[model samples]
Target: MNERLNRLANLPLRENLQGLAPYGAPQIDVPIQLNVNENTHPLPAEVHRAIVEEVSAAAVGLNRYPDREFTELRERLAAYLGHGLAAENVWAANGSNEVLQQILQAFGGPGRSVMGFPPTYSMYPLLASGTDTTYIPGVRSADYGLSAHDAAEQVKAAAPNIVLLCSPNNPTGTALGLDVVEAVYEAGRASNTVVIVDEAYAEFAHTGTPSALSLLPGRERLIVSRTMSKAFALAGARIGYLAAAPEISDAIRLVRLPYHLSAVTQATGNAALKHIDTLLANVEAIKVQRDRIVSELTRLGFTPASSDSNFVFFGGVKNTKAIWEGLLEAGVIIRDVGIPGHLRVTAGTEAETTAFLVRLEELLTQGVNNSPS
Candidate 1:
């Protein structure tokens, strides 16, 4: 912890939060950063120019507060989704994290319980704690696959107010089939539990993989959250939104702060929508690198899970921290996701991917951890 932050902890604070550390991955300044799941591609110039012009127009209204409803932004997002969803079913926020926090605020506050499969997103528990919701950890397979049966069984057991399902779950890139979503949603209905399907990496999923948004027609308690931070290459712009039934969107509005979406944010997101095609052009390239990494890593004797997202999670790591350190020292960085023998790395450009595999191979050949016994 930073010395200054440590001293500030001495001040008055909530008891539950007294000893809790903030959540974040290492933000190291590495030459090739494959840690954070950010789109390594540069922004498309067409989209960049559009954003500049639109934001400049928004700047003219700097004196006025942003639209409280952020109506236009919602409509733009709905159009992008194009599953017969309308603005009434969409809600926008600064980031997917905030969108989740708002959901917890509305449906998961004190006395309510929230449940999620383990080793998913690290933020679920933190969001629960921040909102005074009790966090229940559910079980997944050793490889992090959650079966529909187990999902329903756990939901029935916990009887939580909110159930979070992470498709193409973080730390491991496994996506849930629609059967799993249907099972879990059906299971939750008995307790009136709100089921949240987080699809932050959905854009990177293989074609024909269904989104939870498609299952939203009659499921009122289901909310599917997404972000522009990943495949859209707009992490710096900080736009995330969710799609649900109109009533669920209404519930989020009750908890969101007034004028939460700034005019600039609305404008930037709208402009990005105009060029969604160009912005998402790198997704296929990323998928190529992702698949390449999986094949090459398997050939090198490491066990990598089948990935539908932009990153790969591999085990057979004898020492995760050791491997991570070796990569960092070689000017490449990957995530040590706290799984004993596992690490995750985002798919970057072709050159970056080759650089990572070459350096990792060098480390392995040198017998950093793996050795021919």
Candidate 2:
């Protein structure tokens, strides 16, 4: 055998090797992109300038490693979350995905289980697998709402070590009511399991919904993870954080890589925080666009979920693949969820939304005319 092939064939690997398709966001260069749920707006000029200045200042310290503790950034994040927590209760990572993986590393392992609701963020199972933890899923109801009763039952039966809940859940864009989340938390508490509230889209929730952070003070096992990628429009900057009890945060820190966050990343996030008002102003605009998109989709005979995030999920227009292809061909990109007949579209700029709607109409009309009488 060739030397390279002989060396590669002897490498050790895990037994859990039923490979799954890799997860990826669409990279189609479309004029109207509503596929990945990214903030359509860019950082304001003032924020960009502040970030450049801050990173420039930090450049002198390049010879030194970043603050492994991330003390200042954690403090800022704690304050930004409005959770009455101090820096001791917070941790940062390259992104929310890394923060999540750290949590799994700290709390999950072989013989222990992690649980999530299906049709939610697709990354949950992968994270569980990466940590050698068993994953259990509870399916959402037809309306995309978690059945609190069913969820409680599942927790009692599965006795998972970690429970992952995503508010304003991705793809579907439906948020769990505070009451439902509280009920789930109570169940997790009784089971002595950790509950992670993934609030990546919490900023887009309706006015009345309470963030999981607000419920953290009394719940020792509850951990809330937030990302700067969504409402903050810092997807490229890669700053995400988790707020938990100090002990839990310490455990996560144990697994985090030193200098995982670059000085520029921290600087960019700090600048973004200083301009939270500007960032949220764009969120308000997206909320309005989300409402309009949902309404238009419904009027076009799609059963759209009542979305509280910057995206909308709809169904009942069969031939989802055909529609997706037609839209892509027309320079529009949207996500085709694995769930049959369902599609998720993000609320982009008003002009992009308009273009998507126009393309959607054309596809639907063509589909109708081609159908057998």
Candidate 3:
């Protein structure tokens, strides 16, 4: 591996790309896999049939390029979002990552910067780098929390061209109050900044967790991105979209590849949207397990954070590495998010959740060292 890396380093890669690692989570196979925050439930059989039928129809037209506009998908997405959004106010890409990359391409590049709070989504900095945009790591509170005032103040200080906010944030699995989005957007106006709220996990958020989508009515520069990969159980389909002003879609068009979203992708997304209720039923079930994980973890004496998303991020480990390895040995796998004393786990089916909890309890009983590693 070292030799291969050395050979690649000699190639004429872009300066910004030097020595950067690719972004992804560990893909280890395990009995109960909950590392990536995927919806563990299988797609409803009805939705599965609909997707196959839609894809089958789309296959007949493979000879031609997909609708470059993917117009119908946009319309359906808008209807699903339902905040007075129209097709003109929507755009989509393979996943929210690509949607965000396009945002950086349109509004950020060398000499421009994008700011994001640390211990948030790991991808934001990597995306900024990939787009040749300067990545400014903004500070979060000591406990990985961000308040509206502190967030606004950070934006004012950085004055970046783009700001990426992840609600019900990754790794931490907690939702941010809309006041943070509102405050940050106001602060960014002075710089004409493009503010993006990544609500990739929004569907799993606990009740009354307000979305930044509600703040979209007047904020043209603000964008709220969502994905079918999570609650919709379409991770393999890779359909992610955003809601913003009509002009924002037009701006992304300037930088987007021709026919970026394929006909099949559009079809699959539309089919799933048709069964939105059915797919979302799994979200409630997953949330049940998520709450259980939180409650049970606290009872086990691990300090689990309050999570609105379908995952738990917890601390109070004496040996983080030991607990992680012990869980792996027990045939369950979760994420060790590189935080000093905290780890994250996605809520799976009741059985999967039970397996994880039972194994975790056993590991604690067996006295796997908790001394921080």
Task: State every prediction's TM-score relative to the real structure.
Answer: 0.97, 0.94, 0.99
Model 1, residue 372: what's the lDDT? Answer: 21
Candidate 2 or 1, higher TM-score: 1
TM-score between candidate 3 and the true structure: 0.99
**Cα displacement (Å) at residue 337, model 2:** 1.2
Among the numbered candidates, top TM-score falls to 3
Off by over 4 Å in 3: none
Candidate 2 Cα deviation (angstroms), residue 199 = 0.8
- Lowest-sum lDDT 10-residue window in model 3: 364-373
Cα lDDT tens digits, model 3, 35-72, are 99999899899999999999999999999999999989
List per-prediction Cα lDDT, in the order shown: 0.91, 0.84, 0.92
Error of 3 at 115 (Å): 0.2
lDDT of 2 by residue, 92-140 (tens): 8988999999999989988888999988899998898888999999877
